[model samples]
Target: MMISDLPADLLDEILSRVPATSLIRLRSTCKQWYNLFKDQMFAEKHLRNVPKQLRVLTLKENRLFLPSVDLNFVPPSIEFSDELSLNNSNNSEEVHIDSAFHCDGLLLCTTRDELVVWNPCLGETMWIKHSEGSKRVKERKPMYALGYENNQSCRSYKILMFWDCDELYDGQVDGFKVYDFNSNAWRVVNYPNCFIMNSHGVNLKGNGYWNAYDDNYVDYILSFHFTGERFIRLCLPPPSQGCMYTSLSVVREELSVLRCVKGSSKIEMWVTTNKMDTSASELSWSKSFTMNFGFPVLVYTGLLIDEDKKVVLCNTIVGDHLRGACTIGEEDKYYSEIAFEGMSLSQPPHIFNYVPSLVRIQEGTELDVFGKSPRRRGDDPPTRRGDTAMCDHDFQFSQEIDDMMS
Candidate 1:
């Protein structure tokens, strides 16, 4: 009864309990393990096993560069492969990343060339084709990004380069093009210039784009939607109207706008909640834990949860700790010794957690969690990122949004 002798179902169950960082090597155990690991269903199961509390990050030390994400909480957990191990000869120190956007369970890295969809968990990757090539990409700086699609699920994702090259979002103000995972194409729609969130990802939903925009000369938090390819604004959130010590980013599947609503003198942390009110809403953020760490002025690089847990993973300067905690009355905090040498991509660490509409893979059927859409066959690709994918990444030609999800 060796490890390979375990039945596929039982093996899958066992694999699901392991962290994603080390799952790759288990393939060498035997043909059975390799097939089980490669099967989409089995892979999905393993993904479910990856605890959301595991924090993934990009590390640049002594020219040994690697875009790494981690699930430090898992047993036997200190895995950091599937990431690039860089060196002086790489000559890439000049091309560095500044921020990280942990979309869904994946990470979006802004590189010298373009916005790349990176799966540090699986070691698979894809680069969105821009007309300027990698050289011109240095000049055209894209500040905000929301990774709507990743092609790792299928081969058509390869054709993504051909279609997306035409949709260079420059000078096309308020216009958006979603990527159709099924059709392997790109579609365009007109939009308005909303807010530009510099250090984090924005909140999202089927309804509106919750962003900061100038309303009559003042910064007003706004939500814009595409009605017939035209920009239509949604109702503004009340609390975000006038607040300084606050932050806005998407959580779960709804638009979560977090602000420092309340706090005690010694332990002060912010409170964030969702703005979606309807059947579509999945999770409502009602938890508020105060913080006794860094000053308010300290630049917050980004924030994410650990595999659907209450813990929020954050990356910051020297005084910051690996895990989230409150330092009250001089008591110490638990910190991981993961050292990131430089600050090319803002020294803040990355935490991937369970979001509002997001759930850690578990008892649910394979339907809720899929890399592809449930829509139909034969149509042009989506013009935006959040569009649907077809069954097993067999994208539909013209699958409507309602039919895809519902």
Candidate 2:
């Protein structure tokens, strides 16, 4: 029998094993196949069966880029090979992505005036306009985290938006809001006071994690659980007095952290010893590896680790006007640079992992909680912010970057 002649159950099983990239092209093969891809149950099964390929993604000047890294080389190499198309509709103007957060296969991106959930693999976009109350703090540009519940019955995606108290200006207080996909509305939530170091959070399983400091200035791994709508404080990889910079990333489906010592010129890698779903008290870490760079390295953005190859790739400012990705190898004190041309000196490029999947985005309708309509496609865009100076919340980070150079 031909492949297309197979039974529905057999075909579904076979197709679920195919990689997500290939399924994108096969969606048009038949009406049955197209509808199968839209089924929420099928999407979950496909994600589980398909092997996940984690690759580095960089955003430059509001455009998304995929970097191709080959580890077979003696020192490893990286190049910009592909760009994910963000313009899918009739509008020719490209939206300026002010910030982006990734969870599962969907990207929660924000322009100056609009918030959208985008699936690059499926080329689907869901635009969610801000509520009227959110406009009061529009100038502050609140940080966002996209996550889902860990329930087995069904998955509910949510976007957590909050302004860091330190980022507040003119004596403004912080605000917290959660955008529920089911209700298509934003609801307020109470949270504790903590300074989240990065605007973009590290997503693992169905929760969001960030390197943060409590009111006491003691650093710890801060997590926001979507199911419970609460913040939990977890221990870090032990405290180090020489630790100048600490960043978070996910590697091989596990949470990993990179700690850069100020004067020692050494960086240590740590990974969670057990699954994060366990109790916060039971969470722990084990040192993966360490490398020495002759100069003090600052890794506040993030880093990609190749445990098998013993190499780490991180983004850095090469000179006054150039930004590049430095590849540090085993037993090699020096790093090789792959400088990115035409990079903006004012805004340093941010690096994170992107996993392509078939997650579907449900676009919000015209009606909102307040029964008011949001900005339409033809509406004029909001005024843009002109200044490029780092925000006041990042004052200590700026000082540390300067100390590294001095």
Task: State which candidate has the highest lDDT.
Answer: 2
Give the C-alpha miss distance for residue 348 in model 1, angstroms: 9.1
Local lDDT at 214 for model 2: 51
The per-model lDDT (C-alpha) reads 0.35, 0.67
* Per-prediction CA RMSD (Å): 13.1, 10.5
Candidate 1 residue 210 Cα shift, in angstroms, is 6.2
lDDT of 1 by residue, 1-406 (tens): 8875777678678777764434543433445554455565554445445553333243433221222323343311222333332111124243354434444444445555454444433333444444332343423433333333222452112111111111353322232454433443456544455333222434243223433443243333443222222334433334343333324444444443333322222222333354453232233344344434434323233343432333333343333433321112112232232444444442344332321111111111122112333221122333443333312122121121112211
lDDT of 1: 0.35
Tens digit of lDDT per residue, candidate 2, span 1-406? Answer: 7998999899889988886666755654555676788777788888788877565677767777776666656556666655654652347467777667888788988776667788766656766667432233445547788998767765788889887433445323257789887786888998776454543477887788887765566777778889889888788888889674366888866788887776666888888888677355546888888877666556645565466766777775423555577777555733566877786755667778777787775434546455654323311111333212212212332232223212
- The worst-scoring run of ten residues by lDDT in candidate 2 lies at 378-387
